[model samples]
Target: MPFVKTTWRNSISFKVLLAYVAGVGLSILLIALGAFALITSRSDILLTTDVAERTHELAGKLLFDAAGRPTGFDDSEGDRVWTFKSLGEEIGYRVLDSQANVALASTDQAFWSPVAKAAPSEQGHFKFEREGIPMYAATAPVEHNGATWYLQFAVSERLMELLHQGFAWPFMGAGIVLFSLVLLFVFGACAYFTLGYALKPLREVSESAATISPRSLHSRLESKNVPWEVAPLVRSFNSALERLEQGYRVQQEFLATAAHELKTPLALIRAQIELMAPDKGRDSLLDDVAHMTRQVQQLLLLAETSEAHNYSFAVVDVGEVAQQAAAYLQRMADAACVGIVVAGPADTQTPWQADRSALFTLLKNLLENAIQHAPAGTQVRVEFTTSRLTVRDWGPGVGQAQLPQIFTRFWRGAHRRDHGAGLGLTICQEIARAHGWTLVAQREEPGLSFCLSRHHAGPG
Candidate 1:
């Protein structure tokens, strides 16, 4: 129960729904209260109206003599007579002349005399007590043969008691309660669906935010069709993304520029070292210069591959690229006493849409890294298909804890022995990302397998 309360408090949709229901309930309650107050305050007026109507109806049925003198009511209509008779001793009426003398009365006249005497002479509602029992009375004007008379009607409290005994008030109260419950349900459902629709743009913005990374810093949340209340937040988020994109662009430009600047000095240093006379240190200096040159070149390539527009994409044969990469690294593999084997489809005719040069670089880097890691006299396997490429090396693979950092920039696992900079896997990952693909490194039984494939939508 506390969990439910906490969730309801924390959830914006639930809070909105609760507030809406409360507002609707309050409005309905106010309306019911107002209606009850009106009915209660005007109850006497309603009873007086009832008495006046009954007096008029009885006046209409009066039978007079030829001299236009007051007489009794005509009972020719059996239904009307039966309705009046059903009231028993609860209803009584009296007709008075201009002299204020009783000209005629109902059969139960004695039961109403005290009430009539206590009533006011005015033609409206009046309250009185008769033998300790409360009574309601009304006086109305009567006209016959151009002479004016008055009629007084009285009803006993027993009539209202009969209505209560019949369960009239209970039925009415139950009906009101049922109506309020149904209205609350309907309003709650409407609030739920309306909130879901109204908040749809927020969900879209969240999804778009989740997909944004350093590689996709230029992407922005869509603002169209967003609610007015949330538009400012969306605009602010897009503005932040724009700033991040500018900063990332500047950082990449700096890296590329630094690499470009170092290339010439390194070339000069290599030339001078080669021009030196043969000595024990001369070859070592040249080797160090060569390694620095290679590191600079890899930095330039990393910066270039990080951007999407740097690659010129086209349809190329994947099998052909794999073979070329293998052949290019064959000398290095032989120097390390590691064999290179390329195996795939029978025809080796796999076609894919990618940048030919970038594709070659990606495959070359993977195979080079595999060759460097493979044990002496062991073969590094290269597999290619229409949708995926796999490079497997039978060497000491990194631990499971190090798998996530394999593709991280400058992250050389414990098993690697290469003197080169650790940008090979990071470059491969960048190239795969540029092509809308994923590069994953899996720990094999006795080695590591790097799989490059298109990003599939569902689980593997």
Candidate 2:
């Protein structure tokens, strides 16, 4: 699987504001359409009703004169017309007296013919298109003289057009203004909705940061919840974190590789030094020089993997570690005819928390010390118990007086006074300290007993 850094995904938030605005706009549209339709319908109905009522009243007034005589209306007829002379102004009408006729003709002859066409004998008002012009007219029958007179009345198209022109555009303009004001409210509502989702991106950021862990270093915050305005910041932060993690990993790999590469050259240098001739009459001075050179090389190795060096720690079992070190020195032990034996349980659960190289070196140095001191054919018994590993060799045992100083750096003992460098136990002690353990030398009748204990595990 391609490695994905989980850190960014775990730490980043993604969000959208447009969805909320769309929803808000839709709701406003629905409500506005519903209200607009209902209000306009009611307005049209009321206006039409008022106009119809006025038309009927005008018909009543013209049919009865001031003398209460039905001047142009017939008591019995299918249609009638009534023209009233009011304030010296002409009003047009039609009549039916057993036949269609102009019972009343207003002074304005231009409007008379159209009004004269109204039929009083018509049971109800009739409307129809003529001359491509609309007309409004009403027909009624009423008695004008003692003899029956029928009358009809009509209105031309101009008044209706004037009504809409004079009223509707201005009303519609006002309505549009009202709608715009409402839209302002709607926009704010939509903005609030957008803001809610937009802010959710910030929440995602907080949640992602909360979940950040070493294993999730590569994952980025989701772009979905990140606001476009803030996305740059989140992306930049993720990029920076990625670079830092890469730098630390590179440093660690370089240190591990460098330490491994340097060991061979160091070992070759120690071997070359060991082949040098003695200064003579110095009492095992050649052996001491070779041993000290080896000790210096071992110290270099120890320092390379030290915390002072860039070392990573991991867990290791003491027994397995002792066996591995014994294996590394097996050839030297065989050449010396020093029998190296390791004895413990099949496995022990006790483990050391330490740098792997340091652990290996600690065990190897102890094993090498046993092999160095023991005589040919002598047995170096390595023992492992629940909490300690003990290496015993049948060599000249350390004197009790010098035991305390054995682990001090460069403390050469009286027994090997002219034969060995003094840093072996000191390096071992440093390794033990690094692992939070202890190293001690117990003087035995024939050899030294080196014991390391797991630290701080005593029970009350």
Candidate 3:
């Protein structure tokens, strides 16, 4: 039951499927952009090349006078219209008397924009716009007998739109076809066989695990047949299961021993109380009762710490928690002459994903432990933020050698007084682990600093 409710609610296969979809979607988006751009560019280039070839052919047909100087255009069939034409290409226009105010434009003139703006050196590719449409234009500048002749042509926005739409659907259709085929034939087949191979060891392991009871949890999944990618995870799971089963055995033994041990002493105390006169042993009886109560509380806390059942994760406001815990401990601190101050800003909201009650207990225990070890009249401070909670006490700082074992259960440091159940810091650390945070005891030179930090999700 303890292991059944553990945290892997979102399975690995679902995450992998989501990753695959996202990866493919991103790849599709990029390919779409590239394919669109390439198709449009090729269309424009093809049209421009056709116009250039025609212009060059026209320019080659030169008419010469008797003096061997260029005289006029070769108007062979008296068709001046054909001379200025872009040779009926899809994306070309011509400039007429460009040095003058007069410029003749084709019906789809927006394509001239890019070809028009191009420098004269570039076989004259430039950009020009006409009538609210954009265009790509290419011009060939030639001089005939002291007169300048210019020919320009453009590809229109309508044509560019048409070109993109024409090619885009086909490209996407092809992508869909290719993607489906690959996933069905290659990836599906590979995954089917690979999954069989991958799950073989897991199936065997599960069979072995299913056959096991609490009596035989020491048996483990075989490591030799496990896939390399999954072996480490299986090994860790096996190790944890082994540890849990051992702890179960240890706890069972402890409970049995403790019950027998406690019953005899309690029975003796009860017999003594029944025999005593009210005035004779009332004070001693009260003291023994109090001692028994403290022992029972300590034992219960130690058990809970081992089980880690005292902790549960949720959003906890640490600043508010500090105030609450400080209030809880104020009476004891006051009796001990310790100045306990919850010094952080009250307006601060530090919502921590943790066990609220366990956090309260952790802080309360640390503060109580500090008050026990602290010099009298010392100040104890508790501060909190979104990612960290810190407690400080002007106690003689912890020693160098004893630092490592400070959070080990039942560890009493050198400055130890009659602090109840040296499991306070151990509980704090255990609670931190349950919430995936860090609980660290740090030396503050003349004092001690305990920090519970939310490990940030990055390399900050």
Q: Which candidate number maximizes lDDT?
A: 1
Residue 276 lDDT in model 1? 95
Per-residue CA lDDT of model 2 for 194-312, tens digit only, reads 66676777878969866654334656767666878988888887887789768765764565566566667656765665576654534355455466556556556545544333445
Task: Quote each prediction's TM-score.
Answer: 0.81, 0.36, 0.45
Q: Ten-residue segment with the worst summed lDDT in candidate 2?
A: 82-91
lDDT of each: 0.81, 0.62, 0.67
Leading candidate by TM-score: 1
Off by over 4 Å in 2: 1-295, 305-309, 347-350, 414-419, 456-460
* lDDT tens readout by residue for model 1, 81-110: 554467646766778776667777764656
Off by over 4 Å in 1: 1-9, 21-83, 92-108, 116-125, 138-154, 456-460
**Clashes per candidate, residues 3 or more apart or on different chains:** 0, 38, 25
TM value for model 3: 0.45
All-Cα superposition RMSD per candidate: 5.5, 18.4, 21.1
The C-alpha stretches of model 3 lying farther than 4 A from their native spots are: 1-246, 249-292, 308-310, 416-419, 456-460
Candidate 3 local distance difference test against the native: 0.67
Residue 226 lDDT (model 1): 89
Mind giving the per-residue lDDT tens digits that candidate 3 earns over 152-223?
A: 545555675565567655877697669856855587557556656676787788787786654456677787
